[model samples]
Target chain A: GAGVSQTPSNKVTEKGKYVELRCDPISGHTALYWYRQSLGQGPEFLIYFQGTGAADDSGLPNDRFFAVRPEGSVSTLKIQRTERGDSAVYLCASSSGLGRNEQFFGPGTRLTVL
Target chain B: AQTVTQSQPEMSVQEAETVTLSCTYDTSESDYYLFWYKQPPSRQMILVIRQEAYKQQNATENRFSVNFQKAAKSFSLKISDSQLGDAAMYFCAYRFNQGGKLIFGQGTELSVKP
Candidate 1:
């Protein structure tokens, strides 16, 4: 079975630009999550969705960050006016959403803001 | 807020030897989950092992196991008969039993030497 997958393994953009990272969770997964990982650091939570609606968005750093999962499937993390501080790897994960099930993660998309 | 800590920034172990990576966390919730994830240079996060806070018995997966001390707020990963394939960055993560986001530690870079 295919695990979570992210698109554009690497992306580079200038500051103030806008970018979108996409994630395709495993089929039949009811829970989806996004996380940001800085250099030499572990991943920090961003947002989580359960069946198309976000269950938690408190981990989003600022208003510039937003994510959505439509049709209870694919998800996208959008950043407005990207900053150099946003340069990090964006990771996507999915789980069965049943009783503390383990999450399956993707390779992650590395975003670089110059 | 929950926090996880991995004091060891790096650790090296000889092949076929045993190695333990330390992790500690602070949380008020009695029921939660702890996980160890391995990230290779490929940047893929893979589940190593998981321990439920309510489960007094530790969790084990093949050569990988966890020593979970709920009262001490400690969770450590022990790898026996380590192999070269085990070389990677290990992260300790925590999530509530309610299931939302994950709080991760700084990570421990493990190197396996022959």
Candidate 2:
């Protein structure tokens, strides 16, 4: 079975540049999630999407972070004016939308803002 | 807000020995899910085990098992016969029944010695 996958395993950008990270969840998964993990720390929730709508985006640190899952299958996390503080590994996960269903995670995109 | 805590930052165990990782979470919600995830050097987050707050019985998966104490708000993972492949960062996470976001604890790095 195909697992969750993220594009550009590593991305390095300038302090003020824009970057986009993509995630392809498992087929038929209706619940998608995004998280940011810093070194030596656990993954922090960023956003969650159910179907084509974002059910939660409160975890996003600031307005600079935005994500979209327009068609309900693939998702894109966009960052505007990336900052050095934004450097971290961005992880994506997906589940079957059932309560208590396990979330399968992607390899993640390591974003480094220089 | 819910918070998960992993007091041990690092732990080491000889191969084939058992090692336990402790995790405690603070949450007002009665119904929620607890999870233990492993991240190897590959940086892929793999689900280790899960426990439901409502279930009194602990959850076990192969060499991985969890001692889930809802009353104590404690969830610990015990790895039996730890292998070198088990060396990784272990994280404890929590999610409500509504499944909006996951609150994660600072990871515990485990090293398996030969």
Candidate 3:
């Protein structure tokens, strides 16, 4: 019954610092995804995991961004040398990996690189 | 390879009225999924409705429904009896049948007035 959940509802950090955003998927969900949404823009896919392994990560913009999902439930998005351009809402979603299962999203974590 | 487009940046409607938001997508794949998601100020993405490409009939959820045109690559969301609570940014998204990353459109901000 619990929807996906993300930690640190808001995070403000200085440029060049490192930051980590965490996500907890819904119970029994086997698929997880991460997305980044800039101001006035639609959310862009960053990574997807169909268990503990990432199935597709082509959407990751650059080397500065990385994500990992271990044990197939929890995921963490880590940014190194954060930039002002990285300021945006980081969203997480999960689904059952079944046919046509709708993804349930978490309240995204807004990250601001000051 | 897949892209979603939302033409309306903002729309307003009186409570109890109906409003439609238009979306179009470009994709070579025939089997895919289309969805409408709502994001409130709280930054949570919620599924509004979904339409499977193979389904000839449109998808509906209560007052929310979608007009999905496969040949034209057009998908539009129609909200009936729009409530003040429906005020939010609406996004059109697309994904392939087997779990993959989502392609989202620039959102439409909807406002409902009493």
Candidate 4:
């Protein structure tokens, strides 16, 4: 695709339900990132992947939140036993390379927990 | 840890006028990158402009320019001849050249009046 693409623009799930968000980054981009944005707040970094390995997972809020980029192209963010506080827009971005490269973002997945 | 701050929660400007959005950041790293992203109602995060901390000259992209003060650790966006389409949430972001993670500010909501 020309730009980073995220699946299921919106998702509504009950608390404690498991949810998975998918992200397809731009072709040839080696770096992918996942972020969470609450209402009236900026996006918070969740995880970063360089190729197939997670370069940084320190930003992941807790064990309930996990992300994977197995093939170095498409990434998936999984939330287990989701809580009401998990309700937010999940954004996916990709950059061509590390170090000063501008990242391209997707439209984001708005997750609403009930 | 690096932190980015956008103090103005909201700002408004008339069409064809100019608007400036302020941003400040704290980082011990000498080499880093600064960015301004626009997120409209559509929820797409768009890159407006970017500045390299090592560069002495400011960066400009069409009507969008930045007043980057490296010494003060401030990067402000100046929009010339603002348009209704420019109404969106502007985010200030920082990233270290060595580390790939991007630290974002609280964001400023921009409203362009007719």
Task: Give one digit per residue, the lDDT tens place, for model 4 in B1-114.
Answer: 889999999999999999999999999999999999999989899999999988999999999999999989999999999999999999999999988888999999999989
Query: A1-114, model 3: which lDDT tens digit per residue?
Result: 478899899999999999999999999999999999999999999999999999999989999999998788899999999999999999999998845898899999999999
Every candidate's CA RMSD? 0.9, 0.9, 1.1, 0.7
> Which DockQ values do the candidates obtain, in the order shown?
0.81, 0.81, 0.79, 0.90
Give the alpha carbon lDDT tens digit for every residue of A31-108 in model 2. 999999998789999999999999999999999999999999999999999999999999999999847998999999
Compute the lDDT of residue B44 as modeled in candidate 2. Answer: 93
User: What does the lDDT read for residue B55 in candidate 1?
Assistant: 95
> Model 3 chain A, poorest ten-residue lDDT window?
A95-104
Report chain B TM per candidate: 0.99, 0.98, 0.98, 0.98
lDDT of 4 by residue, A1-114 (tens): 889999999999999999999999999999999999999999999999999999999999999998999999999999999999999999999999988788999999999999
Candidate 4: lDDT of A15?
A: 97
Interface RMSD against the true structure, candidate 4: 0.7
Fraction of true contacts retained by every candidate, in order, equals 0.82, 0.82, 0.84, 0.89
The TM-score of predicted model 1 comes to 0.98
lDDT of 2 at A22: 98
Instruction: State candidate 3's TM-score.
Output: 0.97
lDDT of 1 by residue, B14-108 (tens): 99999999999999999899999999999999989888899999999999999999989999999999999999999999999896788999999
1 or 4, which is superior by DockQ? 4
Identify the CAPRI category of the predicted complex in candidate 4. high
Q: For model 4, what is the error of residue B95's alpha carbon versus the real structure, in angstroms, after optimal superposition? A: 0.5
